[model samples]
Target: MLRTVSVLVDARDRAEALVRGHEERLEAVAGQSRRRPRPRVYTEEWDEPLITGMRWMSVLVRIACSDDVFPEPARQPAAKYRIVTPEAVLACRPEVILAS
Candidate 1:
């Protein structure tokens, strides 16, 4: 069981790193964009059953198109993820919501 856990952790780290690398390359090529404000984004990993927000070290890594709504989470590293209520999400006034 320990071995399996270790392997999964290793794999998750590698995947996160790979994604970060790709994001870095894309950012480099894109360079800085206009000063216009970026939209606040709320992405959901799951719906119907329950609502959860994406929270991890990787969330700090910007993507080409996606923008994060909550800034506090990005500053938090030790935290993995958390469940959010609909009211909380609404309070953010996210310009975009990615639900799956």
Candidate 2:
């Protein structure tokens, strides 16, 4: 099954230019970077009187993309959701914030 899926995915890549489209563009923009540093990022759900952040799979997305994603020591594989104090965020000093 794994071999079959790999073959199918490879065929799809040849037939479909849109496969990994965004990744291709981002790579182009990245320009064969050698010493380029990944930007630190923070993803949050809201910012009312309190601040909270995404954990586990959500945070994993940024890490996979090679971004210096923040809110370390996530309560992952345990609490899918968690809190992020302003102090902690400030300490991370993220270059980008994805608040949604």
Candidate 3:
């Protein structure tokens, strides 16, 4: 029981550290942009972990935004997901055929 508690604590600490590091990087980038005279156009995406349950499951929080002056061009769209199969891989590389 004590071991399980220790593990949970460790996992929580690690998650917190990762979140802190990401936040620091974001701040650094923002600070650099502030120093520049011209407006910068770029998208920044980050995943925030939301720990839940006794086992410490993380839920991803994806956020994407751009700092562009033009509203029309400032739109930063979310990434699209695609499903790839073994057949597709084999088509590209006939030498390495995968067995079902």
Candidate 4:
């Protein structure tokens, strides 16, 4: 069991590093283009966890608005959801995903 856990942890770290590298490549590509400032992504999963309401909504909004990269949602409120189910949460959507 411990061995399995360690292997999984190592895999997760590798995946995160890959994602970060991809993002960096994307940023470089964007910079090379004549496009305006880069856009920010909400990058959330639709699930019950987000719906449970643990003040995440407030935090996301606050962080987005304060961040120059992330723009406000098109409509009055954002419709994106967060993964709450144990299975979904363990799906490894985040490098350091957190749930309550």
**lDDT of every model, 2 decimals:** 0.58, 0.56, 0.33, 0.40
Q: Please report the candidate that would top lDDT against the real structure.
A: 1
Query: Which lDDT value does model 2 have at 30?
Result: 51
Worst 10 residues of 3 by lDDT: 53-62
lDDT of 1 by residue, 1-100 (tens): 4445657777766666667797787676446532345667776655653344545422532443446765555454333444566888898898877665
lDDT digits (tens) for residues 1-100 of candidate 2: 4445657777655545554675586566556443566667676655763344546435444444535344453434333344657887788787877777
- List where candidate 4 sits over 4 angstroms from the true fold: 1-9, 35-71, 75-77, 80-100
Candidate 1 residues lying further than 4 Å off, grouped into runs, are 1-24, 29-36, 55-61, 65-67, 71-81
For 1-100, candidate 4 gives per-residue lDDT tens digits of: 4445657777766666677797687567645643443222233334443422234433443333322111222222534532235554345233333223
TM-score of 4: 0.26
Number of residue pairs clashing in candidate 2, backbone atoms closer than 3 angstroms, sequence gap of 3 or more or interchain: 0
Q: Each model's TM-score, in the order given?
A: 0.49, 0.46, 0.33, 0.26
Candidate 1: clashing residue pairs, number: 0
Error of 2 at 44 (Å): 1.7
lDDT-sorted candidate list, best first = 1, 2, 4, 3
